[model samples]
Target: MQKIMLTGATGLLGRTLYKTLVKDFEVVGTGFNRATPPLYQLDLGNQQAVIDFLEQHQPDALIHAAAERKPDVCENEPEQTIALNVAASEFLAKQCAQRDIALIFISTDYVFDGKTPPYLESAQANPLNLYGQSKQRAEQAVLAHSTRHSIIRVPVLYGDVSELAESAVSVIATQISATQTTAHDNWAVRYPTHVEDIAFTLRDLLKRPENLGGIFHISDNQAMSKYDMACIMADILGYPQSLLEPLDEPSQSAARPHDCALADSRLKQLGIAHGREFKEALKSILLTA
Candidate 1:
């Protein structure tokens, strides 16, 4: 079996990918915090530590999901965000290139400034916020360091989580379950892709490393506002949809992309079909919860 090193194993997407990939690959997982038996604690901000970890493990491929993802926090702490998102990614890409290892960099839809409806893999990135700029720079670094790399850009994602706050989708479920007043963004639209779909897609991509390289946008084709998502969660979980308060384009310290939905026809063209629609995945998560 080929070996894989997965960073950010404690995160929503990282944890999901780690679990699914372990079924077929010898997975070495790491997280900054909440390190368990298999997942080691590694400070990705420290360049030498990341290099040392890669040298020691020597995995055939590295899936980098670690990043400072909070838009507000990233705007406030540009230095720290750059340290983790851009600098760390550059270091990883360089090391992977040296060893001829496959590198899969998890990116975000924020790279596009929401001006375009459906961004293709070939679309030029024009980030509006610090978080998007950081991720965009990191994507460029990966491309510069190696040709054998996959930069997968995803939109809002949620899946089965031990805690509701772990993801945006689950957070809505938690709020409605408690019958608490929740605010939803009605203006800003996003593609709510499940983490399971991303995990399955990543697994399929890794299986054909030779055929997969360069940038790819992977997300469900459906576009819905946050208010719409809240309503769906409320309808599915038997909670009153009235509990969700619709806000029209609320102000944010960090500028948000209005419509950052991604197009995943590239994955379809590559013969990898992802399972579960948004409604189906949301129902599964809430019902099981």
Candidate 2:
């Protein structure tokens, strides 16, 4: 079995990926605080710690899922964001390169300014926030340091209870369940992807390391606004749509990209299978809960 090293194994995506990977490979998962199978407490920002960990484990592949995901938080701590997102990633990529291990970097759709619709892989990135900028810088560092690297850019993700409030759809679902009203009448547009699909896609990519290298956009095919997504969730949950209310976008504090939809044509063309529609994915998650 291939030995895999995964960072951020405690995170939403990281946890899901870890659970799935352990089923098929020899997986060593790492987190800053939490402990799980093959879990380590090493800080990636600590160069010596990272190097020592790599030297000790020496996994065949490295999947980096760790990052300060909150845009506002990143804005508040730019230095910390850069250290984890860019500097640490560079160190990992270099180490992986030296060992001829495949490096997989999880990136975000926020790298785009959301000026255009259905962003393609070839489009130029113009991040509007510190988080996006840091991720973009990290991607650049990974690419520059390692030729055998795959950068998978994911949009909004939802799955499992852990990702609920963190996910736009889950947040709306919980709000509608509580207040019986739509909270996001007017917010922003994005393509929501299921975490399971992301994990499966990563697994497949690892199997075909050569074909999956470089940047790839992974997201559901359909795009919808926050208001529409909320209404759909209410409908799926058998809640009355009257409870849904739309809010104006200008009323929000954080500057969100209005149309951050990603195009998954490349994924399809490459024969990468994706799972359920946004509504179906949300329904399955609620049922499993």
The numbered model that scores best in lDDT is 1
lDDT of 2 by residue, 129-171 (tens): 8888889998998888767787889988888866467665677
Model 2 scores a C-alpha lDDT of: 0.82
- Output the number of the TM-score-best candidate: 1
Candidate 1's C-alpha runs over 4 A off are 177-182
What TM-score against the true fold does each predicted structure earn?
A: 0.94, 0.91
Instruction: State how far residue 125 of model 1 sits from its true place (Å).
Output: 0.7
Q: Per-residue error at 282 for model 1, in Å?
A: 2.0
CA RMSD per model (angstroms)? 1.7, 2.1
Stretches off by above 4 angstroms in model 2 are 177-182, 185-187
Q: Over the stretch 103-144, how does candidate 1's per-residue lDDT look in tens digits?
A: 999999999988877888888899999999999999999999
